[model samples]
Target: MKRSAAAFFVSVAVLAAGNGVRADGPDEHAGRAQEYILANDFDEARKELARGKPDDVGIATERARLALYEADCDGALVTLSSPDVAKTEQGAMLADIARGCARVTAANVLEEDHDQGVWIRYQDENDRALTPLIIETVVKAREALTRDLGATWPKPTRIVVVRDLLSLSAMTGLPYESAQTTGTVAVAKWGRVTLLSPRASIHGYSWRDTVAHELTHLAVTRATVDRAPLWLQEGVAKREEVRWREPGPFDDRPSPDAIAARGIELKLDLPLDKLGPSIAMLPSADAALVAFSEVASFVRFFASSTPPGSLERLFAALRDGKEPDSALEIASSGNLKQWDTKWRAYLQSKPKEPLPPLLSLGKEPAPNPKAPSLREVRERMRLAELLLARKHPTEALSELERLQLVGAAGAPQDDPSYRYLRGRVLMALADPGRTKEAEVLFQDPKEVLSSYGPWWALRGVLARSRNDEAIAEPSFAEAVATDPFDVEAACETLDADSPTPPSKDPSPLCQSARAWKVPSGTED
Candidate 1:
């Protein structure tokens, strides 16, 4: 929930700083493009490339990276296949994906809640089963975050469910494995979330808690206008992941003993102000772990020792444009310098206990591949998407049609991509007579698919093709707003040019689409 993918990934992308570039340089367009990409402004990153240095290997690599960001492996392959790209370090990494993902049959994207958040993901079997858990988590998170922060999120957030670590990594440019490892269950950045599915937890992380943790990050990010210190952001999110009442049974969370033991290494840590940026830039996993533990512990201390509304006021001060040090002074009558002294004294009073190895609080190690994982469905779907992209929709349909017989058993007939391809093949072949049937596929987008902005954008395209302005207008609007970076959604929304009535009297069709849900999330 807490990590800014931009911060983490841009750092990872910096590894292959091209021939002339070793890191971001404002003087170079390549460096500026990296900055834009890090900020999650892919459109601007492209603009930077267009302005100059379009041939820079580093910049070219970032451009290919953008295609993967949208889960278009084939598109990325085309970008990186060139001789120039093959010579760069990043091109090697991007090539691995483009090569592997060419066999993919399905694809990615998502849609909205009633002013709550958007449910987003690629087309896969888990979509239905994962919907309710995600919706429940987001609703509770929004309510909880609003109460805790005494503020509301400035914009609606997208809750993206990733099918694999690679897709998530590509989107964020953070390495989930390899050298720059982040034991990230989920990340909240640019007012959105990207996470693994329910069973994708690494270590002993609770999936629900992780979702809540990320949503809290989004809320805090908005509250502080992304100006809050890293310590405060991470600490508050870790603490607030659970609704506080009294200390209860271990959910295998970091215990007081574990945290205190971890903190022992930080005996001479920097004062809070100086500590802020260091935590984010720590070079090793061990350092990252210690930073997380110490900050979580300090936040617990600050919340407990402070007056009733002090923490709340602290956030308010930051929101109202106070500097970090000034905000702390105004909120606590002491800045980090004083707080660090108090926290150190508080730590000294704690009793020591034997510390165990850091492991998950759960019985399972990593999830055993006991039964079918998502790989099969995702691969088949990706394959179909690849075929469609190649302008062979009929061939794509042949692949999708075969896909329907096996892996899609529990899947709803209304599944967006499956149904989407049905209509697309019909349209691609110019079969106007069966267009009515194609229209049916986009009609009732299931809850699992509803939050998927691409399907809605697809629906908009389908509707607009037949001059069905009634459906096209709202569907496109919903899609664009749900996933701002979705190229198709953004384009179609503009093309539809849906009337914008006064905010009070909004379109009913759009309202229904925003609140759309599936009939039943389970087989029973």
Candidate 2:
């Protein structure tokens, strides 16, 4: 997805060589390199070139081009350095061209936007007028941060939205390399939010929610500067999104459902002294989700019970370099322990609703009796799900391919789930060559099946591929937490050496565990 011409160039060179005529001159070799790059054969292009030579100006230029294509601007600079390059007629021109390319690539990779002071880019490949909407949302978010946290809020933040996932990922180096990645990602440096196009299509719901979520991260980062704890930052962000969504004035009080869902007894009162420390890091997916959910719930309670302007006061204290506990006490007019007790009492008194039993597919036989005899197409889907559950992703893919053909007649458009499933299967296959295809498919918003356990698990796999352990860990946890029985087998596969699985029971308020079901007729 990170557009590299090196591979393309290499392929063209190989194909040209296969025609039984080797390139004789600098121009011919350079032409071949251009062709290979166009064809996406970077390896072949690199193979055809001579390295570190001043005599071959064409080869040197091609190498510089290849370096730029591969995102190695530094390499490009070094490749362009030659005495012959300075003296030759075309050499100086080629060197200038290479330098310009390197500069643009470097700016794209590292520099923030001059106007907004954020690295955010608005993409409109489909030529949609979504840029205005992004600007509006950012303005609103900024206002909310200023009103709530005043001097503690960071300035010059940027927000980006891409029309397609692949371009977004390629540009941001984010997990999944696309907007179609399951959700939004916040790049801390510029406080940039990258929203995939499909997710953006949800309009009022998806885009606004994502903006609120990412902005909360930005606000918390500013509130604590570099001193914030990871759990606290994530927790506060999660809580703020839900809070901002409530109707009328911004009341700190959480919805009754949120209060009831988070149990009073399980409240985590992590000491400010130990809060930023890494002792709470959980390798197990289940533990991590629980921790995130618990911290989110805790923040919600704290905000709801505290006096008006208390949150603002706390931010002000932090900005003045006060210790966290002292700042909290000054803000609330009491120690955190007292606030904790009050929050616990408030939660206990709230009305409660019993949660549905965790989906127990292991003990109970499959309940969807209609699943077997529905149709050949539906049956294939069922088979694919079963195969995925059994960890036979290859077999599942074969079945899905057949299903895709069968469904092509009547259900051509309703194949997001199929594509999503196939993407997962490919990830499970784990061949490095297939990572690109897998990433592309995963970026399709339609491929994200909210109700499917394996879908989230596959997202986890893709996240891991991109080295995003923070996002991946929670995604894996969501899979197991969504349906403990179905994902129990897969959870075992994640940590075979550990023997005992961490608690798979859903937390009182598992954020992602709450279904992301879109209406049946909705299309992005």
Q: Give the Cα RMSD of candidate 2.
A: 22.0
Measured on C-alpha atoms, candidate 2 has an lDDT of 0.46
Model 2 over residues 1-524: C-alpha lDDT tens digits? 01111111110000001111122235566656644543335666766664323356677766665664454556766866777555555445445545543443342323344554343444543312334444555666666666655523333455545545344444334333222222222222223454444323222123444466567655654454334445455556555553443332212222323423442233333432343322123222222233444456666677777777777677667646576678888888776667656655665666764422121111222234333232665667667767776778789878877644532432232234555556766766778866677767544333322223444556665776577778567665544423322222234223223222344443322222122323222322
TM for candidate 1 is: 0.48
TM agreement with the true structure for every prediction: 0.48, 0.41
Give stretches of model 2 more than 4 Å off.
1-119, 122-129, 151-156, 161-184, 194-205, 242-289, 356-524
Report the lDDT of model 2 for residue 143. 68
* lDDT (Cα, 0-100) at 66 in candidate 2: 62
Candidate 1 lDDT, 55-118, residue by residue in tens: 6676677677656544456888888888877876668767875665444224544445665645
Candidate 2 backbone clash number: 19
RMSD of each: 17.3, 22.0
Clash number for every model?
17, 19
